[model samples]
Target: MRTALSMTLSSFGANRVDFASRIHEALSRVQRGDIDVVLSDLSLSHPFDGLRLLEELKTRNLLKQSAVFMIVTAEANAQTVLSAAELAPDDYLLKPFSGETLRQRLVKAVAKKQAFKVVDQAILQHDYLRALAECNARIEERDPYVIDFMRLKARLSLLTGAFLEARQTYEQVLRIRPAPWARMGLGKSLFRLKDYPNARRVFESVLAENPYAMEAYDGLAGCLEAQEDLLSAQEVLSRAAARSPAIIQRQRQLGELAQRNADWPVAVDAFRNTIEYARYSFQHDAGDYAQLSQSLLASGETQSAEQTLAQVRRAFHTPQSDLLAHVMEYGIASARGDAVRAGKSLQAAREQFAELKDNLPGTYSVALAEACYRAGDEQAGKEVVSSLLRNQHDDVAVLRKVEQMFVAVGRESEGKALIEDHANDVVELNNAAVRMAQAGDLEGAVHHFLSALAERPGSMPVALNAISAVLAYVGQHGWHDAYMQLAQDLLARVGAQDPTNGKYQKMMQAYRMVRQQFGIKGA
Candidate 1:
């Protein structure tokens, strides 16, 4: 295939073509030079494939706006195709194609890439509103790729949290043609709008047309989960995982859903797969080991659970991991009715928790709280959970998990009261700052939010509010470098934590516009 591609390109008067047989070599080559095209096969050496290469390029931002990536593979199964599509490859060519056919596909791919160059540039800059405007302008011009622009416009709308516009754009595309991607987009838009029943129907329709659509399955599962249909959601995710088992996030979600349903065996298998697959991906976390051990314990495999905890101690050397291992050990010891071991583990966990409480993730803190409750340290448990709530006051998922933990320990009412109190405190703090900003005391608002951030360093809402206050001050007063830098730092933190957040995207767009307005260069 390489020889054929080279010959075809050479025959077509190509300027130059570089080839690499391995993923690392390919990445190195791309890093060394500006390449216009990347051609890869789906299957490469074990554990390294075309998809991995694409992912690496994307992660490093190696692919320029106009660079075209084409995957030439003999594998045409639904899983392989959907997997490649998830990465949004420019083109997928099956093997045994003629030289002329390859040339045509390459021409079309390059053309499409060129057509969306402006929109892609804006998107690369995180100026999603500009990108959406570009898409709309291009669509109005009636370009040859109008459908592509329409699709992109719908996606940009979704990214900007313009769910109504996204729904309308997707509906327009579906009226033109019942494309599965458009249907999926429509479903996602509906889901965002909290129209779960309609979203479910749309996703179901997509699956009816193409049962192997992995994204459709995911969308359907999300809709079901939103409607509190845990069993149905778990089943949908199970089927999706069976089809595309390489997706670590899907496996992790499946495991969590199964764990929620108390399907210990399935949870064990899914978490095990998550751990294994995560080893090769960026989604790896020490929490995966903790989850697996919990599942093992629930399944009456205390020995395996202990081994899993031991593996965590070996696999990760962070304080968080140490704390997690001790917590899991306490659970294991309690399951075995070893009072002495349980007490020792609980003591170790408490010490670790005390040392790392300020920096620990909410999930780990929750685990520590549960261990504390089991050890009859109700005060310690309450204190840990309260701190976690303050840091993550706006995170509904974490709050739900904390409530569940309390309920498991027969403290549901107490948990509710604690959650409500913390939530109201955070709300009042935020509202006070917002009132300052509304009253034209922008500096005061910024200072208030900064103080809040110092107190609750891990609060996403506080971070976002601080950024807004800083930006508002900059916009109204002038470009204060310290305030701008502070906003940028907060944005970097938020981006690192949740890059896909719509609010973050909007904030980024606002940040860029502020810089541009102030004639700030080289940001």
Candidate 2:
């Protein structure tokens, strides 16, 4: 205990307590966050005893909060240990423990806490970069607590949209400790990366460890959903929701899944529960309201759905915020068999979107398409779908809405052709370059990408890919200045287009890494 305290004193900068028999005075210092661990006698004569001290720390949510509450009592009974465990002190120390044992425990505790602290603070504040940096530092420490660090860091990485990094972190953590949380993280990361087979393996492994790991169940469902295995996804989420009845998010997700599957009753129940639980979070979107309205409409609850739409409008006033509400209002009007009101509502929604056409291509297309569909102008609906099909070649969300419109207008074949063509074009371009590169034809790959970019000048992915290939070629040919200048110009354009595009941001990072490695300078 002395060795641990001494190490804590040196490493974490905790103040030293006088070696006195009065444990309360020492614990008083511990409460001030000056100490990160408390090695105290179970019995104390102070107004607040050791158990009281533990409870106080837990309530304050301080650094010393449950920091290591060691009983240090010779009378270690099952009842006392059970009570201690219930209070959730990290580790319990028995009486007559050696200094080395104490040292190991404290070291492990400190390392785990230090590794987790950065992630905890980052999560508390939603600062992902600091969390990732801290995780990397902890990974370098090579301590036994590295798995915990990796698990936490993987979650942060996923939040920051660093799915590949999160996947690597989860893989490393699972190598050390095949815990349910780590496996869940791995599954989620792989799911994000669209690796369904591997993701399913990770999720199944999590269920193998803990069948009640509801999060893994949700992840497995998500993987199935991504693969368009909707039936399996529904079964997975339904089982999870049934097993763990308290997680509102899971229920909400299940509702969304059920809604997508057109299981209206289940969707309505899930969404209702979701709204009940998500009333306080900033993450609460009008999506639940919109989903509920749709589900209610599907269930023939016309009056309730209309009321929900009205409430959504009162809650969120912006056209963008209330787009779904307006759409739902149109749905309600349709349900009431009021063709005149339905046409008016759809027209108003279309106008609302048109005014912001430059900023909302998808919204404009969707609103106009819906307006035309209900107005019985099949030609106008076709035009709207065509416009969206042209402008939203790579956006899955927009494309899906377009597909929905296609189904509504009964132009299923045209819709299939349009979506498949755009997707295939992109896949072909990406695949050709990748194949050439793999076949040791780097120059040929660059040429093909450049020609493709010239043909489709505004294609961000293609343009960026061309630049990347050229940069690779230029680096090999010792044309550092030319490539660096081109990269700078391309990066500036990417920033102008959208500072949040992952491919562009990654290309920029690669440029920086290369420059740093080679000490390359711009001309």
Candidate 3:
């Protein structure tokens, strides 16, 4: 698939094509935004395949944007094609084709992609309204690719937060063919509308017919999580990760869920695999190393835990990773009754974080807080939790972590009070902003929303509402670079919180529109 395709493309005046031999290298390039188009094959070295690569791209939402991806399979197996629908590849080329056929297919794919530049550009700028209009215009003109435009319209509606319209569009597509991607889109819309029971059934049916669908597993897991069936959620993720170990994101979640279940053995293995697999991708997080060492300590393997900590210190050298390693070492020493070392490490972290209030990522801050609490500086730990809560008042995961950290320090009452008070404060702030907007004081509304965001950076609801007000003001007034940047920062924070958030898709659309209005590139 590599050497031969290169030769074929070269025959057609292709200037350059990187033939990647390692899965990790190719995935790293994709994550780094180095590849604008990807042509992959079904089979590869063990534990790696084109589908897994496509799954990662889809999860990152790269497939829908500027990049063009095509998968070459040896045979057009019904299930393989059906499962591949989830990623919505540009085109699939069956094997045993002549050079002319391959050339023609490539030519057609490239042409369609070029023609899609306008729609793609608008989406890149987050102007889903413009994108939707362009798509409708194309459809009304009865373009030969009208079916394709219909699918694009549905996706645009979904991105625009037009849930009902998205649902209708999906249904319209499904009538022509029962594609898993379309059906899954319907399920997603249902999930967004909070119709869990129906969403669950649709996801189940998707997996039933196309068991290899990665998004189906994610959707089913979402359904389980919403129901608060942590055990089932863990099992669902466990099964999915087992089949697709290359999915390091799922592996990380499995580790978290395992810890919550007190399944230390599973947590240890999951963290270990996450650390190992992350070495192969550009998606490394120092937080996983901490999780591994802590899980080892939880399982009563102090020596092994310390060894793991030493390895982490050697493997990653970023400031955050350094802090993470120190925290883990302190955690290990505290577990072993080495008070002196624990206290020293706690002081080191405190000194590093002394000047900055909201400098570190939430996960890193929480890790430091845990280590500090264990090292006997309960106040420092509580303060970190307070900072995190102020930003992410509605993040259930952060809230749970806050509860756990505070309860460990014998400050459960204070933690609960802090949570309630800050959550209500954010709500009041947003309510006041809404009132301002209603009273035709859009500028005041934007001001209060910005202040609310300053107090609580991780609140997606607040960020979304703030973004709405800013975009409205921009539409009525004019584009200001300051407001655009504020909206951009909030979107970045939202992404830092959870890129997979359903609302995240909608917010990015608005963010693009703001950037477009400001005549700015998305970079």
Give the best candidate by lDDT: 1
Candidate models: Cα lDDT each: 0.82, 0.65, 0.75
Local lDDT at 151 for model 1: 80
Best by TM-score: 1
**RMSD list, candidates in order:** 3.7, 11.5, 4.6
Clashing pairs in 3: 125-512, 126-512, 126-513, 391-456
Query: What's the TM-score of every candidate structure?
Result: 0.87, 0.59, 0.81
Kindly report which residue stretches of model 3 are placed more than 4 angstroms away from their true locations once superposed.
Answer: 22-37, 43-48, 55-67, 73-84, 93-101, 111-115, 139-143, 156-164, 373-378, 394-397, 400-416, 433-523
lDDT of 2 by residue, 186-231 (tens): 7788888989999998778767756655567877888888788988
Clashing pairs in 1: none
Give lDDT tens digits, candidate 3, residues 1-523.
5678789878977777776655667766665654657887774223456776776665555454546777776744634544535457777777777779877877778777765676766664455666788988988898877767887788667655688988888888789887678888888888877788888899889888776776777778878877878899888888777656766778888898888788999999999888887776656777888888888988999999988988888888877777777788788888999989987887777777664546666788878887767666767876877777776667676787777667756778977887888888877887898899889999999888878777765567878888888888987798777887777777787766555455666677766766677687754
Residues forming the 10-long window of minimal summed lDDT in candidate 1:
78-87
Clashes of 2: 0
lDDT of 3 at 361: 68
Q: What would the C-alpha RMSD of candidate 3 be, to one decimal place?
A: 4.6
Order of candidates by lDDT, top first? 1, 3, 2
Error of 1 at 474 (Å): 3.5
- Looking at candidate 3, what is the lDDT of residue 169? 80
lDDT of 2: 0.65
